[model samples]
Target: MQLFAYLESFPILHIFELLELTLAIMIKRLLFEEAEITAREFKIVAITGPRQSGKTTLCKHVFKNKHYVSFEDLDILEEADSSPRSFINKYKDGAVFDEIQRVPGLFNYLQTHVDKVGKNNQYVISGSNNFLLQQNISQSLAGRAAYIELLPLSLLELQEHWGNTKNPVFFMMNGFYPSIIAKQSSAERWLPNYLKTYIERDVRMIRNIENLNLFSKFVKLAAARSGQILNVNNLANETGVDNKTISAWISVLESSYIVYRLQPYYNSFNKRVIKSPKLYFYDVGLLCNILGLNSERAIKQSNMYGAIFENLVISEIKKNRFNKSQYGEMYFLRDSTGNEVDLVLEKDGNLIPVEIKSSAKYRSSDLKNLKWFQRLYRIKGGMLINQSTENQELEDGIMNIGWAEVANV
Candidate 1:
């Protein structure tokens, strides 16, 4: 029988199962395309991202025919730890090593193996802790490995896999972790557990913190301050820790991919720009969880609604750029005089200033900062990203893009 006829002949429940399975296989990750291209040019490819950000799934999916081994297996880790050379020899044909940070010594052996073989795409390595993975790469696998960051699912990926919906508010509140979408799990249950696992295990492994409670408090405080300029002194006072300590903790969070700091854009013409970097969480769902926002209604009514919206847009831009194998430098343009542009994307010598808003209505004042930025920089175009559904060209070069259409912009 033909495929459609055969599927139709199955019971209703069975058809649903078949459809789910098909979708599970058909879902293509944005990074997977670039990863495959990188693998062809490098001896080794290292995929690093936050834990549970679909690193394992992306690597496996892209290199489906390759042998796979995970260092997370205690016995395998012990074996690899004891005899790195021997363990590497066993996968001489090439293999995917998941969580290779757990086996740091293996990098030296892999380096030797790749040096002798001199083959492209001979080994695929993945890790959740970028600091450890990057250190190992720099020390042992430099000039041999192609580093690719796989952040959480982008809005484009979500739209491609799951049909686009009108309710972006729901997505912003829930965030875009792959497993949460694949399993249709509740963010309330998943995010808390994710936070606990990351804090109790990953943080401990990365740093030696005496008081978990204090670290947890610091994380929450940082989340509360998301989208605001990072002030180490203020954070130190709020957390009751020294500025140096606060800086160290924030570094740990940044290295672990928990948060990202958007540096301010300063030019000769704009000498008044603030030098401080702005803080934003990599995942808004985790931010919401940290802030104890349990429902969509709460998020909508909260005073931080605009900041959270800005955070989502900025992160999406970052993810989209990374997925395309482009290291687009993103910054916020703000001056001491209080003139600010929410996001400034610098690519190919052109600066694209983006202004973000949570409201559906577009006002002339919304583009005030963008227009000023254009005049100062002598730029022809900019964008105003907001919740409005329609895309409009409000002026000669200023375009008002809706939140859903941000990926395309």
Candidate 2:
């Protein structure tokens, strides 16, 4: 609010001066267009993401005309839980429901109401818990609701306001959480509390875990394993838990949007590829916090620097894809002998292998895997995302683009 007030208080002459220099523009989420389009096509639209990712803010901004209701209020939850039909009827015209997963049974009443009315855009619902929200959607609003996954700010979204002066490593350490970035707060101070709340609230709501300490340790251990192939047995040994428990915790992490498990590309061409999936954090800043790296110097000098950079690139690409409403499959390719492509993006029925390197200088040897994968699969093009400032074309139709340029693709 202060940010807006400060902008409004700026002299009108200065505002026009900034506009003439093409420096003034509205700071908005790229997913706004996708959500607005979905609202027009479906009777119910569901926005889901991690806690404090600005889902509620985006919903309120897009559906401002609709009456806003949040289940976080105990009174509203009580009313909805007791009389689901009445709650539905009260907002028969249209409404935006925040944290709808809090009352799963309400979805049934919503389904009946929308069916009777046979109208589009009757309700917009959002929740942070994907497991519970998706379960309710599958049971009640299967064909009626369109889904959108919103992550934190991507580089493209941030460049709208901050420009391109910041580097990839800078974001890798501080992350793209909107509230922290907007307030210019220290990630070290904010992310720990955010992680604590997620563990205390969302995890308990999702599954019964008697040992919060053990679960917290499991999360930190998983963070240390970012950008590496997931090993359930190793994690079990390290966390003093069984493989089953480790697997379950990983599922909980993914469902809560704390981590992502990138499955390996198994479509082999006369070679045995690694079948295990790679683990990556949804936000690298959270990963850094979990590892106790509070400073840029600590992050750059840590042994996990390469892993952090890799996670940053992959997660940024993932966020950009979601922002653009691209729901395509993305995977990593690794063979038995350790030849691998960091990422494989599925678009238009073709697999484009991508090589991710933390090096600032381009080298021909880095493109070896990209060329090999292209020739083996008979693919025409591939991408190499690195820290370089320049873009160039290499052998075998492969293009080397800077990390910030991922938003464009």
Candidate 3:
């Protein structure tokens, strides 16, 4: 059965009926659409993302007929690590290899097999550690495999699954990890363990960190500074580490797909644009956990509420574009004169400035940065994504878009 259908077969109580239905609908992810399109052309396909983001589930659901093996099983991993050729021979027809990064040596053998067969859609590989998986891919599987990144679920996908009743604060607090949503688990209970596993497994595998506690502190500090321009020196001082170590740790976070940096937009017209990139987590629920905000009410009242909301909208835009198999050319705009826009999406020579506001109340002044960007760049239009329920066309090719309808924008 499909993942969602399998979940639906459980006997749900009357009180839990609505949530169960929502989970059932969410089983149909946007990445499946991208996977189907990619499978037709590539001899091997790889899906990379953070753990529990549903990489394995996606490959299994989309390639139901393919034999499946997971490297997490130590016996299988040992065999593949010891003798990759024999392992590949065992799955000649094709197979989905979960956590393929565990056995990087297998890539070379798989490459040889696929080249010999000259077959399309011969293998599906999934890994949570992008640094290792991508490095191995470049060294061995380049030009032989297609790649897709599957992040936590998108707001649009959640809306399609649950309808319009979900509060924005709820999404901000809970985030979009599929397991948390599908099983109706509390983020507080789940995210701490998730962080522990990430630090203990992926972090150690990526780099040698003698002090795991210090690394955990750095992660929390990074979360505290989410949505702000990255300052490695400051982070280093706070964590009592050298600047280079701080940089390397941040790279670990990024390569593991735990955090992303939004590069600042630069144009000849504005020489004073900020050059530093802003930091953001892939899932707000994880951010909330790092911040110790357990409930929706807590999230709404927290000091970082606006920043977290902005993070969610920015992440949604990225996820939406990625799901459609489009490269995301997203940036943030800020100048020394204090003009700033939350997100600047550049595509095909057209610039779309998006302003994010946490309040439901919309005012003309809320779009000041967007208007300033349009004027400076001579861009025809911009978007204001806020909590307003109605969409409105404001002055000067600017539109006030409700947060729920951001996918349409």
Screening candidate 1 with a backbone cut-off below 3 angstroms (N, C-alpha, C), the clashing residue pairs are none
Clashes of 1: 0
lDDT of 2 by residue, 256-320 (tens): 89999999888645558999999999999899999998888998899998889889888988988
Write model 3 residue lDDT over 1-409, tens digit each, in one string. Answer: 6966865776665325445334434557887877987888999899998887877667767887999899989999999999999999999999999999989889999999999999798999999889999999999989989999998888777777777537778777777887688766777788889999999988989998989999999999999999999999999999999999999999999998889999999978778998999999989889999999888788888999999999888888888888876654999999988999999987776788999999998987897898888889877778898999999899888888988887654
Model 3 spans with C-alpha error above 4 angstroms:
1-26
List per-prediction Cα lDDT, in the order shown: 0.87, 0.87, 0.86
lDDT preference between candidates 1 and 3, better one: 1
TM-score of 2: 0.92
Q: Which stretches of model 1 miss by more than 4 angstroms?
A: 1-24
Worst 10 residues of 3 by lDDT: 14-23
TM-score attained by model 1: 0.93
